[model samples]
Target: MDLYRNIPRKDKLLSLFNDDYAKTILNYAIDQELSNLRKLIADNKIHKIDEQLLIKNIDKRYNELISGSLKRVVNATGIVLHTNLGRAPLSEDFIHNIKDIVSRYSNLEYDLEKGVRGERYHHVVEYLKIITNCEDALVVNNNAAAVFLINNTFNKGKKVIISRGELVEIGGSFRIPEVIANSGAILKEVGTTNKTKISDYENAIDEDTTMIIKIHKSNYAIIGFTDEVPYREIPKIAQKFGLLSYCDLGSGSIIPGIGCNEPTLSEIYNYGYDLVSCSGDKLFGSVQAGIIIGKKKLIEKLKKNQLLRMLRVDKITLSLLQETLKAYLTDSYNNIRSVNLLGTPLTDLLKKAKKLKRILNRHLSDYFDFETKEITSYTGGGSCPMHEIKSYAVICKSKKIDINKIENFLRKYHIPVIIRLVDNKIVLDVRTIFEDEFVLIKDALVWATNQLS
Candidate 1:
C-alpha cells in the first residue's frame, strides 16, 4: 500500500506553516504527527491518507504545539477562589503597580536608604508587620512550604503534637502527618477524630515533645457533637510545658467583614501562639505564598535556617504581596479582586444576572430560553467549606440544542467560558464574571448556538 508514501515529508509539512512559529517547534510537531500516523498504519487503524488532509492535520498540530496550555478563561462557575483556575485573581491595579519593578531593575535586595546589601523579605515584611501587627513576618513559596519549614526548623528530630481531628489532608493529597514526618519531625496524634481536649495535648507531651501544632480544618468541617480545645488554649498549654506553639490557619483570613467563620489574622495573633502561618492566596486574596508571622526571635530563627533560601519567594511575589498589603493598610478592600468578588452584594449580582439574561434572550432566544435564577456560590480553594454565598445566575434551556453541546462549545471557545449545569440547564453565575467579560460571554454563547445549528 502507498499509505506510507501518502504521508508528506517533514520538509514539505514545514513549508505549510509560514507563520512566526519557531522552526524547531514546527519540526517537532511534524515529527510527532508523522510518528502517530505511522503507528496507526502499522496497527491497521488507518487504511488510507489524503495528502491535503495530512497537511491540514500537520498545520493543526503546529498551531497546537506553539499555543501554550495556560490561558485566560472566564470564570462563570461562581467559585471565587477557584484553585484549579489559578487560586486567586490578582487585581489589575496591583499588577500594574508592580509592572515597573518586575520589568526593570530595582532594589530587590538592596536597601536604597543604607546604600548596601539588604534582604528581599524586608520589602514586604514592614508592610505585613503594619497590617498584621505581628512582631515579624516571613513569606515562602506556598502555605505547605511554610508549614514544612516551620516543622523542620523548630521540631526536627522531636515530637510535635496535633489533634487527630485537625490532621487535615489539603488539596493534591498533601496530608498533615506526611508533611510533618517528612520534615524530620515525629507526629504525635492526640484525642479522637471528633474530639480533642486541652488535656489530650498536655498528656501527649513528654521529654521528646518540642511543639504543639494547631491545624485549621479549612477545607472541610466536622460538625455536631464535636469537642475541641480552643486555639487560644493550645498556646497556653505549650507555654506551661516550655514548648513552642504554632497555628497553621490554612486559609488565613486577613480582611475583616468578609463574613466567614474563619478567625482573622489579628485574632490569631492575639491567641498567644509563638508563630502563625496561613496561605496568601486563600482568603488573604494575594498571590500564592506561605505567610508566617510570629515572635521576632522565632522568625529570626526561621530566617537563619538553610531551607529558607530554597523556600524564599521571588521579587515578583514580594512586589505583588506588598501591593496587596498596601491595599489592606489603606482600607481599600475593593481594590483586591477576590475580596471585591466575595463582598459583592446579592442585589448587585441579581441586577447583573438580569441584565445578562436580557442580553442572552435578545441574541439566543431563537435557540434557547434565558432566565435569571438564584444560586449559591462558594469561596472555593479549600476555605469555608460550609459557607454558602447567595448569588444569581443566568439559566439557559434549549428545546433543539443539547445543553452539554453548548457547554462543550463554550468551554472550547477561544476565550473559554466556564459554566455549571443545574437541573440539566446551563447556568452562568454573574458573581465571578466581570462586567468587561459580558461581551465575551455573549460572543461565546452566540458562537455556541452557531455551531449547534
Candidate 2:
C-alpha cells in the first residue's frame, strides 16, 4: 500500500543503464525519476507504482540527460538562411577539407613569410578586399560587433547622425539606437520614421557630429509615400562637411541580382561610403562574422582598437569565410550552399520533390498520401523580407491519423524533421533540404508512420 517503498534503489536503477554514461549522471537520472514518482504518490494520482513503468521512465530520463540540445535537423521549412536553424549551413565537404587546419595548429597568427607574429584578420582581408573592391577589410564575431567596433572607434562621446526611418531592429532585439548608445556614441535621429530626406541628415550634423550612418532596413519594408535619403547621398553630405560616413548594410550581399532589391557590396562602396559593415552568415553565405570593409587607414585604426580582441573571430570562422570568399571570387557559386539553395531553379526543385515523393510513397503509401506542391520560400535571416522564391514541397496527408499528430511525431523524432503544416497537411519544402538529407527524411517519415500506426 506504501508507494514510497515501491521506488527502486539507485544502484538497481543505475545497473539498468550502461557505463557509456557517467556514474554521476546515472545517479542523477535515477534520483530525479524516483523523486518524480514520489511526487506522483503524494498527489494520490496512482494507487501503485509499476516497476516496468518506473524503469522505462528512468531510462527516458537518462537519455534526456545525456543527449545534447544541438542535434542536426532537416530544414524542411524552405527558409534558406533560417536564423533559428543556425543562419547559414556550411558545406560538409568544405568543412572536411579544412579539418586538418582547424583541428591542428597551423600558424593562425604567425606570419609564415616573415617568421613573426602576424595579424589574424590578414587571412581573409585580402580576399574580402578583392571581392568587395574595398581598400581594407576586417572580420569580427558578427555584423553587430562590427557596428559596435566602428561606433566605439570613431564616434564614442560624439554625435552620430542617422535617419529615423533607417533605425532598424534585427533579430534578438538588436536595435541600432541601443548599440550606438552602448558603444558610447550619442544617437541623433533625424526625419520621420516613414519619411526622411537628405536635409534631415544635413541639419542633424553639427560640430559634435562625428559620423553619419545609413542602415539598411533588411527585415522590413516601408511603403506608401516613403522618402529617405539614398545611401549614396550620405557620403557626399559627409564629404562636404568633412565628417565620417558609414553604412550598415545589414545582411549585405556580394552576388548581384540576388533579388529583393538588396544592394551589392560593390554598389555600396561605389556610393562613396567611408566604411561599410554586413553579416557574413546572412546573404554572404559563410560562417557567422561581422565583415567590416572600407578605407585602409580606417581599417588599420579599427584593428588597433582594444575592443577588436574581444570581437575577433576564431581560426575556424576565418577559414570557412576565406573558403566562401574564394568560391565567390572564382564564380564557384555551387560551393556556397546558401547561394546554391537560393538559386536552385524551379525545374530542379520539382525534380527533387518528385524523387523524394517516389521514395516516400514506395515506403509509406499505406498511411499517407504524398504529392508535390509549388510553394513560396524566403531568403530568411532578415536579408530580404519581400522577396519570395518559387519552391517545391512534398505535401503529406493522412486520413487515419491526425495531421498534427504526424507533425508532432516528426518534430519529436530522434532526428527531428522541422516541417510546416499547411491547411492541415504536412509540408516539406525541398529548397532548403539537401539531397543527402533525403534518406533522413525518408527515415523520419518511416519512423513517424510506424509510431503513429
Candidate 3:
C-alpha cells in the first residue's frame, strides 16, 4: 500500500500487481483482446487496438454477453406484418412443412420419378408459373435480388426507362434509383415525380433502351391531379421497341377485396408484361422470397446468370413456400393468415370485441369503459397505402391511466396486447387479431389490470 500510495492513479492501476500476477492478468487480458480481435479479423474490419483503451474494450464485451438475444415478443404496436417483427408469421401448414423437411433430408435436389439429381427450383417453379399463368418462373432470396438478377442479366450497361413518380423509396431507405445504379443499368427518368405520361416513356426510348420498367408505389400514393402511364400501355411501348416490359410489383397481392390497390400477378400477366417481380412475404403471405415470372426466353436467360446461383433460395425457404403455394391453390382461402385477416368481417370483429370486453370486465370493470364501436384497420405490409378496411373494436375507458400508459402496459404484458389509443383510451381492434388469439388477449388484459392494481 505504501509503495503504490505515491504513484499516480493511472500508473498505479496498471501496475497494481507483482510480476507473476501481472503476467497472468496480462495473459488473460490478451486472450480477451484476441477473442474480439479475431472477430474483427473474420469480418475484415481489423485494425490496431490501443492498449490505453483496454479497460473500455473489456466493458463492451461484458455488456454484449448480458444483453438479451433475439427472443419472441408480442406485437402490441398494431402494425400487423410489422417488418421488425419478422414481417409475416408463417401459417401452421407452412411451419409444419418446414419442420418436416428440415428434420429429414427430403427430395431437396433428388427427383423421385427420374431417380436422379434435380434442380432445387423445380419445387416452386411450376406452382408459381401455374398460379400466375406466366410462361416461366424463378425464385430468389428477396425481391431486391430478383430485381438485381433481372436487370443485371438483361439490361447491364443498357438504358432502363422508368417513371419518376414510381421510383419510390420503400422501408429501409432503399431507393429505386440506387437499385438501378447497383444493377449497372442506366436509369432514364421519364417524367415528373407526380406525373408521367406514356409519351414521356415513348420519348425516352432509343437504341440504347433495353427494357421498360414499371415500379409500383407500394408504400405511398399520389392522389388528386396525378397522371401516370398505365402498366398496360408500357407493354405496347416495349413491344414497339422490341424490348421487355418488366413490372416490379413490390407488394403483390392475390386475394383482392375490401379496397386493396395492389395489382394481382395474373392481372399483370393478362395485361401483357413480359416479366413481373414481387415479394412473397408481403401480400402473398409466405416466407421471404422473390417470385419472378415472365416470358420463357427472358426467364431462361435470368436462370443462366451466374448471380442467380448466388441468390438462389435455400431448402427451408423452398419447402415452406411450396406449402404456402398449395394453400393458395386450394379453395380454402382462410388457410392464408394475411388473407383471413384482410377478409374478416365487421360482425366477426365485433363478436371478438364483445368477448374481449367480457374478459376484461371479469377482471376489472371499474378500470375501463367498454363499448363496441366502428373502426378502421389498414391492409398493412405496404399492399394498400390508401385503403382502410372498416372494422369494429372494443374501446377501453380509463380514468386513472392515460391512453398511452394503458397501451404501454398492455404491450408489456406477457402475451402483449396491441391496442390503439383512441379518443384517450386503449382501443382493441379485432380485425388484425386472430380468433385463436382470444386466450392471449384475455391473459394480457388480466396482466394489465393486475399492473394497475
Best-fitting candidate, scored by lDDT: 1
Sort all candidates by lDDT, best to worst: 1, 2, 3
Per-residue accuracy of model 3 over 30-99 as CA lDDT, tens digit each: 4575566556656756355444465555444444344434545554334555676777677786676578
Candidate 2, residue 433: the lDDT equals 89
Give the range where candidate 3 is weakest over 10 consecutive residues by summed lDDT.
1-10
CA deviation > 4 Å runs, candidate 2: 1-12, 15-18, 31-51, 65-67
Candidate 2 lDDT over 1-453, as tens digits, reads 787887787777777777787888778878888888888899999898788998888778778877867898889999989999998888877798789999999889999999999989888988988887899999999999998999999999999998888888988888999999999999999999899988888888888999999898878889998898877899999999999999999888888766356898889988999999999999889999999999999999999999998999999999999899888999988888888888888999999999999988998888789999999978999898788888999998885788888888998889899998888888999998888888899898788877888
Give candidate 2's root-mean-square deviation (CA, Å). Answer: 2.1
lDDT, candidate 1, 202-283, per-residue tens: 8889999999999989788888989998888989999999999999998888876673778888788888989999999989
lDDT of 1: 0.89
Residue 327 miss distance in model 3 (angstroms): 1.5
TM-score, ranked from best to worst? 1, 2, 3
Global local distance difference test of model 3: 0.77
Q: How well does candidate 3 score on lDDT at residue 261?
A: 58
lDDT of candidate 3 at residue 397, scale 0 to 100 = 84
